[model samples]
Target: MFDVCIIGGGIAGLMLAHCLPSSLSIAVLTKEDSFSSNTALAQGGIAASIGPGDHPTSHATDTLFASAGHADAERVKLLTTEGLAIIESLLSRGLPFDANQAGLPLLGREAAHSTKRILHAGGDQTGKMFLQYFLAVTDDHVKRLPYNSVLELVLRDGQCVGVCVEDGQGNRSIIQDHHIVLATGGIGQLYSQTSNSSVATGDGLSLAFHAGAVLEDLEFVQFHPTVLTLNGKSHGLISEAVRGEGAWLVNADGQRIMTGVHPLMELAPRDIVARAIEWHWQQKGPVFLDARKIQQFKSKFPSIFTNCHNLHINPGQDLIPVRPGAHFHMGGVQTDEWGATTVPRLYAIGEVASTGVHGANRLASNSLLEGLVFAKRLASKLLSIGFNFKEKEIHLAEVTKEFALPANLQVRMTKLVGILREVDKLQKFNTDFPLRWFDLQHYSSLHIKDIHRYTACSLIAKAALLRDESRGAHYRRDTPETSEQWTGKTVELSLAGYTFGERLLKYKESMS
Candidate 1:
């Protein structure tokens, strides 16, 4: 039993733990070590309006623009405004953010940002630095459980009370808690090529859904415009900050790919740039990121430099192979300003929660900021509410099959549900695979994780099929234009089904 059970060990879970009072017992459960998360893999730094000539409003405006006007105005304002304080607070705590020679924090711009407002540490190692910092400062009293996967949320009386967790050796147990927070990160591993870690298999989404929590915007999967590709496989992410430093996207024939694609060209919103590169790659063959012109490339992005070096490709001399791949999720378990989900005593933050700040597309580098701001908010709310013990009747489902992930799941998802979408493909995907939030009694913990991935992929496909118009990261080739009808509204999915405005539809498989 615990006072607070946070399901994830990333920055958001750790940040929440840090903010909570030591008087309360807190346990953070993770499938892997703390560093194995999308947060740790983040190459671009956190975004804040702290640079010269930048303001929170400007930051919010850029974020809204990147979101294609689908973002919540109030939440975005809060995210950007509070972001500055958090960065400053980290600095005051002696976080050695990369700085200019004069000791001012070095700020760099990314695609869609109006100004240079990104702060990094150790060049491209900003996320790593943050992970270390949060892990170090987190109170020792807070328990950290690695290699523990949450199989299901235990709900009673319409409120979440605990969770069914599985350990590394396949041991299972129930954790009774006053509060349960799902900070389990994104669903990128559902795709064949992604920048997310192996643990990002949509565990939080499925758990929340089964527990009757609402999920929003599952279709808005952001594909980073530049992930290093070699021999048709993703090597690693090439941060957009490279373009912010004057890198260019070129074709196999050495022609500039983004010259007339958008006014911002290589520095345009990720959705625009990714589509452009994909189109060019299809029409003119492979595409590459030309960073030869950037001075001190190795010093500015050591991680990327080392990756390229390992591949024997010199960014300063060669055209680095590049392609778009799954990068960030713009949606997940829906939450309010306080990170409280629709379910009582259950919360979500970080990439797992759809706070509606990211909207249809996430602004580059705002991800880290979202994790920090919302985790703090949720923590404060939890501290104020304090703890109350509750015991619910325990129920265990009968075990059946031990299924593994399908061999072709990733390929099918990448082809049908990825980058570009249309009605025909989406319908085909649904017809072939379908949505099945399998009966717990029919599946064991050993195979529940695999089932979750399939269900998550189906849910994403369903959401993509429902939203007919192209907007932000969700681009439908058939209905290529954005629709005013869908703007500012969300696609809310639950156990009963989902709604996009007045149309409420139920998944046929879910009913069974």
Candidate 2:
């Protein structure tokens, strides 16, 4: 038995380990190595109001504006306000944020940001730097179980008591712990073309759903505009900071794609930019990032420079091939201010938990900040509520069928539920690719993974089908305009089905 069992090794989980005192025994588990997470691939850096002339209020305003009025105002305020202190604390603990010659933190601007307040380290390797820092500083005694996949959340009497995990060599074991934290990252891998890490298969989201936790805004999937395209698939991500430095999106005729689209043009929120790129792709041929204007791209963005080098595309001359791809999920398991979910003792942080900071769309660079800030808050909350375990008999749900997820699920999801969404397509997807809670309770790890993928895709489709309006990342072509009635309303899903707002009513009844 352990005091806390964190089912991830990303920034949130590792940061929590760093924050917790050494007195408590903790276990951090991940399906792969500790560094293989969305945190390790992030390039745009963490957002905070630490730059000169930048304020938390301004940051909060930009965040809310980008969220399309769907974000919780109080929670957004907390994220921005508390985020500053967290960033500062990281700096105090020897985080080497990039600095100017004057020894001030060098701030970079990203899409939808009012000013330059994004902090990076090791050039474009902000997430990698953060992961290294967290790993180095995390408590030495914290047990790390890499290559251990969490198959199911063991529940007893409506409360999560433990987990059933599978090791790399097909070995399975049940571990009972007092508190469970899911920092299992995003649901990007559900789409065929995505910029997320391989482990982002919605494991945490599916686990929460089957364990009776509420999931909100499943439709709000953020498709980043500037993913590097290779052989008609998403190969890698080109950081938003590259465009922040004046790279323009151009079409076959060398015309600027984002011209007059929005006042910010290429710097508009991710959803708008991605839509613009996709529109260009449909009307014209291939789209490219014209980065010929940016000075010294090699030194400033070393990773991007290397990627371009490997592709044999010179940043100074050639147009870098690009397109929009699944990047982030604004919606996730619903959590309170203290990172506590509806299910008792099952806390969540990072991209897995919807703390309402991102609302309908997440502002670029806020992801890392949200993870750190919420992890800190959760640590404080956990410390206050000391550890005590009352042993309960774990009841594993009966498996109904050994479901093998369809291979074409990713391609189908991308087609029906990608950048553009509509009622007919969503309904078709729901009908053809149905997912039941019963199929999720399986003994095989591979089967469980497949169930998670299908369940997560189903959740997103159902939520998107229900919300008949264009807002933030969820743009329904049929309902191109944002509706006033849909204001403050969110589509929430669980094991029973889906519904809207503060109601346990059936989805059909809520829609009516």
Candidate 3:
């Protein structure tokens, strides 16, 4: 038995472990190598008020504006206020941020921000640098169980007791603990194309929902505007910072089209940019980013330049093919300011927890900042609660039995609720492959537990269908206009007490 069992090994989980008291026994269960995560693949920098002419208030304003009316004011204030200190704490722990010639902090600009306040490292590889420092500093107090995938959350008397994880050899074991934190990343892999890593299968959110935690904002997925479209799959992401550096969004005829759409043009917020690109795609054939005209474009964005070269497409001479891809999820397992869910003895942080900071759409580069700030908050909360490592009697067979999701359901989920969602396709998806409410009673294998992907996808589809207007990433081609009242969040759950639409209305009313 350990004091805390973290279900993921991403930056949030790692930073949480790093911030905790060394006396506590913390065990981290990672599905793959600790280094492999969406955090590690993050090319853009962390948004914070670290440079001159930048302040958390401006950052807060940018975040709130980008969220499109669904952002939690209190949470946004807290996160933005704590942003600088979070960066300082990471830096003190040996994480390096690139500095300018005047010995001041260097900053980069993304699409939504009013100021260039994003702190980066080694140019575009900020996430990689952050992870490298985190892994290096983590001491023996933190135990890593790599290749262990959490199969179920162990619950006793309506409280989270621990987690049951499966090893590489297919052996399952329960690590009973007084507290558990689920930091598993986003669910982008559920879509046909995304910028998220393969491990981002919505495991943490799915486990939390199945374990009776309320999930919010499942419908508010963020579709990034500039993913490199290649060989029937959109893989590479041309960072929003490209526009910040003067790159223009152009169409098939090499025409600058965004000027006719939004006044901000390429510098408009992510949702606007993505929708504009999608609309342009419908009007023309393909949308691309013209980076050739910018001086030192290839030198400044070396990573993107090299990646484009690998694909045999030179951004300096040719237009880089781009499309909208599922990039981030603003909605997740609902959490308070301290990253505590409604469930006692359970906590969530990073992208897994919907802390109300990123409501409908996440501001560019704010995700990394959110993870850093909230992980620290959660660590402080856990430390205050004190650690308890005494082993408790648990009904292993029964606990494991209650968790189940079928395999076929997973494939069906990916098909139905992917990047481009529509009402007819969603209804057909539900009719063809209904959610397995009955099969959840028995002890399920990994293949079976994966069907929660269907549960999650179904929720996203239903919520998307329910919202009659397009707002942020929850776009409906049928109802293409953004409505005044539709600016709030859309929530869904598997529990019978609340219908999906009712839950959304309740959340909206609560916010009001």
Candidate 4:
């Protein structure tokens, strides 16, 4: 038995492995090759309060503002305050953050932030740099099981003892461990047009939900404002950092977008910007990014420059056609400050865990910071509370229900539950899905992946249907205003059903 089995090879899981005690046997598992994650594709820099003339209070305030009334003030404050260490740690690890001649990291301004507090490495490849640095350091020590998909979390008595993994060759096996950390990335792959990597299929979210963990705010899906449109589908992301460098949004009719959407205009938070772009696209035609005015844009944003060059669009002259696409989920398996879930010995970090840092919507570039900080916190917490495993007997349960996931399942979800949602469509899907899904589950070709898709989609639909107000990333055309009653609240999904729960209840209370 391994000491810990980490079910992701992304930044969060790998970072945790580096912090783990040397005596412990660590196994890092992933369905794809190691380093395939949202982290690899995250072009925008990570946000921290470690720049010139910046304070944690100011950063925290901006996070709260971007959250649109759903962020936990105390948690945001903590995240920003603790973010100082994240930058420091990166620097200590020899991360080559872009710096000025004075030897200070050059900070860029992002949406909702009052100060220039975003740090980039190798220009716009901040997340990729972080992943490369950490993965290199951690892989040497940890046992990595690449291309093994975790199908189920094995439960005995009340604690999560291990996971059931399906190999690439269609073989299955069980690996028992004392602790399990799910750093599995976002749920963006649930939609057709998304910024997430194909590997991000909500495996962690669905598995945790089925294993009786509390999942909160699955409805708050963040649609990024400016994804590159390749033949009407989202081919890639145009990092928000580009807008930070003075690019503006405009429509087909040469109308500037975000003029009246908010005071910050083009620099408005992702949710506001995405809503504006989507609304304009629905009403008018395609929206484009006007980066012509920015000085030396290609050198500064080489990645986006290459992307635009390949697409035959010149940022210097031509308007880059952009659209809203599924980018991030602000909610998932709810975890407390220590990254512990409602279930025993099961912890979730990264995008899979709703740690109350990003409530209704994530602040710009905070995703990487959240995952890094929480991964270290989880490792520390586990070390403090040493493992005491009284291994219980686990049985391989028989699979009765069997059905193949329909090819059109993703298409239906993308249509009905895309960026903009409404009660009429949500209600219809909620009512019709269960009966149809029930039949699909009992078919001969039912697979574990199909169950995961059904579970993730169902939970998101249920949560979105219950929340009748428009807030942050979860916008509803029917109720276009944020609700005051749902302030500082989170809708939790459990095996029993969905209901309201206080955010970050005591650790003992969570298991109760």
C-alpha local distance difference test of each model: 0.85, 0.86, 0.77, 0.81
- All candidates: TM-score: 0.92, 0.92, 0.87, 0.90
Q: Which candidate model has the greater TM-score, 1 or 3? A: 1
Residue 511, candidate 4: C-alpha displacement in angstroms: 30
Candidate 3 local lDDT, 27-121, one digit each (tens)? 98888897778998887789888767667777787888888777887788778878778887666655778886865568777767898888888
Candidate number that wins on lDDT, 3 or 4:
4
Clashes by residue pair, model 2: none
Residue 189, candidate 4: alpha-carbon lDDT: 81
Ranking of predictions according to lDDT: 2, 1, 4, 3
- For model 3, the stretches where C-alpha displacement exceeds 4 angstroms are 243-268, 279-286, 290-297, 388-390, 395-422, 433-446, 482-494, 497-512
Clashes found in each candidate (C-alpha, N, C closer than 3 A): 0, 0, 5, 2
| Tens digits of lDDT, candidate 1, 350-430 | 999998888788888899899999999998898888786667768676676666666799879988998978889999998
Better of 2 and 3 by TM-score: 2
Cα-lDDT of candidate 4: 0.81
